[model samples]
Target: PSRSATLAALDVRKRRDFTVHDLDHRHHLWHEGDDARRWAREAAKRATVVLGNIEEVEMATGTRNPVAGAAALLDLGAKIAIVKRGGEGVYARTASEEVTVRPVEIPVLNGLGAGDAFGGALCHGLLAGWPLRRTLEAANAAGAIVASRLACADAMPTLAEIETVLARKVSA
Candidate 1:
């Protein structure tokens, strides 16, 4: 299903059942003013998980600190919140704890679609029942691999590739 369709359904139902929202800031460029802020906050409050970069988090939650911003979202009702910090890696928060995953460097050919790759791996980890740290590791690795490549969709790594990246990190 399209993201807009899913978002519309969520808006109507406020269903909390394993919904993941990737708050791509570019998509919300049209949002401004108090009403827009209210809408963004409400949309975040309904999700089981919300993922975005620091800028997106600040734009939605009006805070510069991702962890603090995520905590605010949790107060509004999201179960999990993640802030993607490019080279700094990711910061994830839950009601009980917060964790930051440091980035793993790799050759960078292009940055396009790295975030998409990260989101995909994040969902994969959640669905597979991996711990938050493991999920972030996998997502980070997936994103690094994508960034090292020149293409986006065509360069998506296979499961084996992801596993290899994880293994390398472990050994290092």
Candidate 2:
């Protein structure tokens, strides 16, 4: 579905508290020029949180820098913006603060579902009331774990698996 249509269909008043938009790279093929930016800005405005890769954000905002793109989303009324930079890290920005979670190093076998894994882990952290940094850490680890496995959905890490990855990071 078109981003605008998706936005139009959303009942922000009833679902804003839990709504999150993952402006994933796949959407790039569906939009162009100002339309993409407009849709992105509108999506941000309607959702409680917005998640996108750096490239997606840049494309959506017509900006070269992801941070600038995130700022634009915030200016458009997004409560939170998360820009995922593969290998480098994930950067999360709120009205009050910004946090960067470094990527976990792992051999990548498949990346198709890494973002989905990260988003799921992020939701888990948020629902559990974990701090932003910790949430990002777990999300990043989840992505790394998925990327390192040959299968996508089958590779999604369990809580114990995520903890193991975090523990390895700390010990290193």
Candidate 3:
């Protein structure tokens, strides 16, 4: 954007550690000096993982198609790309694999903390060496629990809670 970068600390570097990028479109900034459409794609070059909502992914990759957007991110060097589809679940893609995890049905109470919970659970799953689909499934469950609750920190789900949802789904 034409407006100066607000967060100068944001830099995607070539690092040995795995990096996850949750796209946060800075729509408030002017785009005269920058191209907002390619921000996520550009950042993907240095990211190991990229995750965003459909709108955000479309804005970043210039495509509303989730599969194409994931491919676009992968083309830009991201190892994994995940498009959050809210209640429809998430579309996760890697060079060799792709998955669309089913959503956990729940009564919507407060959705404010869902994304945060999802991100935290994503990191937890990745760090724990879970496969992409398993990671997304647990992340989705964590988000579902948060959305079904009213509190903030207290609403954040535990690993047991997330696994319980997964276990139930499996048993069903």
TM-score leader: 2
Model 2: residues with Cα > 4 Å off, grouped in runs: 2-5, 12-15, 31-34
**Candidate 1 local lDDT, 1-172, one digit each (tens):** 3445756867776655568877776654563453545666767777888888888888788898977888877877888889998888899998887888888778899999899899899989999999999988899999999999999998888778989988887788
Task: Name the lDDT value of residue 33 in candidate 3.
Answer: 65
**lDDT per residue, candidate 3, 17-136, as tens digits?**
567778866567635766766555666665788889889898888888999998988887788899999878899899899999988888889998898899999999999998888899
Where model 3 places Cα greater than 4 Å from the true spot, the runs are: 1-13, 26-34
Prediction 2 global C-alpha lDDT: 0.82
Ranking by lDDT: 1, 2, 3
* Model 1, CA-based lDDT: 0.82
TM-score of 1: 0.88
Worst 10 residues of 2 by lDDT: 9-18
lDDT of 2 at 24: 74
| All candidates: TM-score | 0.88, 0.89, 0.86
lDDT of 2 by residue, 45-154 (tens): 77777889987888667775767877877776677788899989888888998998888989999998999999999898988989889998999999999999999888
